[model samples]
Target: MSRLEENILRGLNLIGYNGPLLQKTQLPVAIEGGPKNVEYTQLVNFLTNEIRTLLAIDEEVNAVTSPEDSVAFVMEITSFLKELNCPYTALTDGLVSDRLQNVSDRLLLLDYLITELMGARILQEKKPEKKIELKLQETPEGADMRLILQTLRFPKPPPNISITTLFQKLCPTIPIVLNKAGADIVGEGIFKGFLSEKQWEILGGIQKDLYHEYKIREGNVIDTIGRYHTIFSDRTKGKNELFEKIYHDKRKLLKVEPEIDMADLIAARTDLAIIEKTSNSSVRKNTRSQLQKVIIGQVPDRGGRTSEIAPPSPRNAPMATTVLWWRKRRIYTWGREYGWRSSIQRWL
Candidate 1:
């Protein structure tokens, strides 16, 4: 029997399962590196740990000489493996091999040794767990995993319980695809299952900022959004007129209007002008004070309306008088030299 088949038979016997050997799951045993190097490394680590546990069981099996003591050893191994849910369980068929059937009487030391040897040989030959020394050999011709992961983390949500739960589901199931053929080999589609708007923005920003060899693959919306956010995000929030202009443009596109128009300089001055014009017009001094309060955002009811003089028509308004009072305050002061200054001052 092949080494793999031998191990399967032994594992079945030790687990106290009686079954004909059917077939094993077709997991690729080849260790030649490919795009799945990261996954390969992780699996190798897992398998190495499994082998170590099995070796410990083998030592325990050797210490017992009596058949009854051996059975106890086998039971210990079985319980340990059951907890691990190791691949050995999935490899067995239902046929009860004599080596396996006899395991019920005493621990199957011979079979366990054979199985461990096969596992060790496979592990030794396919040493995927060897720590790889990665260095930036050159400016990469394509995507850098380190940089990509770094940039992609932005624009993603501020992680909380919801994200933690979702990531747990992703890490075990998905094969991480490394960029090789080109940097752009990494596409946004790879992240589609977990990408959010925030993450997209972050990744996109990185792509733009790095401008390193790679571009995110075409047709990947996640990457596209990330790129867009990088290109267009407003990082500044204070007194930015350019941002205000851009904001206004978007509002126009989206048909949104602000609750208050801070940009309406003319309107603000118009209100101020009303208070000024009404102040100079023949009206009760107290009434003008109340009107000024209303113009400045405090409203109050004044008694019956006086026969208020009409405000000058915009066209016929005295040219000099039309100037803002503050601007012409000094020039207007010249008129104060006339008795109107003293008379108006006393009118207060």
Candidate 2:
């Protein structure tokens, strides 16, 4: 056997093919380097069977009785390979027309295609398995506990037990109690008979204590809400007063029109114009000499002696009189002016 036939047999064994081994005699022999007249009947049949098994193809492999049948088989295999995304391109028309003539050449082509298909199968097998997630269902006991917790958190008012009991107790012969009511009436009667007068009195006392506590909590909550409202109202009032004081100070300093908005005045910084106007008015009032005296009187002599200051100019007589009146008062005049000293002494 040729090396190509040996390799094909080995490949078939590796791929778990436990059939008869392929021999050179089964394949068509080439005569004098010319094309063989015989079709690749045995070779095509074996290939078709192996392809069907490896690819899990459900279609039956047709018998290759003639060249036309072999061509059709090759086309079918090509279609399968394309669908599987197999990259083997050795099974072309040139393989059938030229290489398929010789036994060794046919075996070589088959070896290549078979090796590729085996590789594809191996890769498919080595892929990671898919994982499945399962959700756990709640049991009946868990569901009942959940329901009980929900009922406790948001309990509904009890039904009218007095009316229900009155009917059942006084009118036991009534059809509603005899037929319509089930085990509930019996259970209620058993529960009432089970407790004594002392037990009932104790339960009543507990209920009254709970109600008293609830009322106290409700009152405390109401008082807290009212106190918070009062505090918030006072804070809001204080904030408004502070804003008004700031607006008043800005108005006095800028001397802007009373109707002018505070936002516009501050944004335009029109206070510079008011300062210039005041400076010009002071100049017109001839207060420069009075200003000079105030500065000179505030400054001490370097030789520990009072400087003999010049008298006010006659032209600045009115300004000088106003300045002299200010100089006669002490710096602690604010307490007398506002009467805060007297108020403090009275409080003490």
Candidate 3:
């Protein structure tokens, strides 16, 4: 929801209501070489913290005696695990004896132990008959157990596919994909089975908060700025700046417009140009499918959603040559800009 809201905010910026949303807000006074004051890193970190708070998952193994404890202990642990909704393998007595009793055979279950921190093991009975007990042992460390639990919290792993790809090739970054998945699950009323009432409320509250915040920013508060600020993003869902909407607005920063159309000047149409020109959904998708990664881990100034349809970074592998050069030159002059947050330090 935050990502979506951010996209909306960025989209607004591209459209050129360059004015700060409120009287108190406005672009910073243009600063030529002075540093940009931004708190994006803190903001992303805050959002992550919110997610951690929302999940509030406790994946730790509870304190207890060894696996040799009474039957009640076994039953209790089993019940606890059932409530976790996490995948775990339980070894039967026979399975433990065959796989764990022999030193050579133990290798077969090593992976299970490493991943789950628990596996079948042979244990001597405390009885006078001196029989045997097979059980799962408590791992020497809790790291693996916690890791497994932590991953389940997201429910959706980050996508391996590129965000700009026409087809879903890779997943977007974690917060975006995971939260989005969580939101969808909520929307479908499926999360009710797993998420508690409070959890649902918390998450819903977050979404509402995000939405309200977006409304406030758009309708009330403004992003005042007054200096050249480099923008960067993880580029999830091809987090576009929607250059087309804001092209003319951005032009104001330039002393004069280039002879070429802003879109052409930026060569906004490259590989995706042909299909992008058409309004057909299929062709538009193909145009969106195309994506190029930022070479140096970041890109400058998002023009807007499908704004320029060009890869950022004028220095290397730019989609546009002269157009890109001037585009960047204009940004250089604007002094104020918006971008995906990479760190507290804009460039960092």
TM-score of 3: 0.12
Model 1 agreement with the true structure over 307-342: per-residue lDDT tens digits: 665566777667656565555565447558774776
For residues 1-348, write the lDDT of model 3, one tens digit per residue: 234333434533433333332122221111110111122112212222332333443422222233343233334333433443425444223332231233222222222222222111111123246459888676734454345436545343344634356123233453465575774442322122356779767766666665555565543322322131124345534433564336446644543212332223222323333344476886666655323344344468756777557666756555467776777556654544554333323532
Q: For every model shown, what is its TM-score relative to the native structure?
A: 0.18, 0.30, 0.12
Q: For each candidate, what is the lDDT?
A: 0.42, 0.52, 0.36
How much is the lDDT of residue 128 in candidate 2?
77
Off by over 4 Å in 3: 1-55, 58-60, 66-70, 88-348
Q: Which candidate number has the best TM-score?
A: 2
| Tens digits of lDDT, candidate 2, 34-100 | 2222333344445656666666765443545555555555555555545545554554434544434
Q: Cα lDDT for residue 135, model 1?
A: 86
Better of 1 and 3 by TM-score: 1
- Which parts of model 1 have CA positions greater than 4 angstroms off? 1-50, 53-74, 80-107, 128-131, 134-348
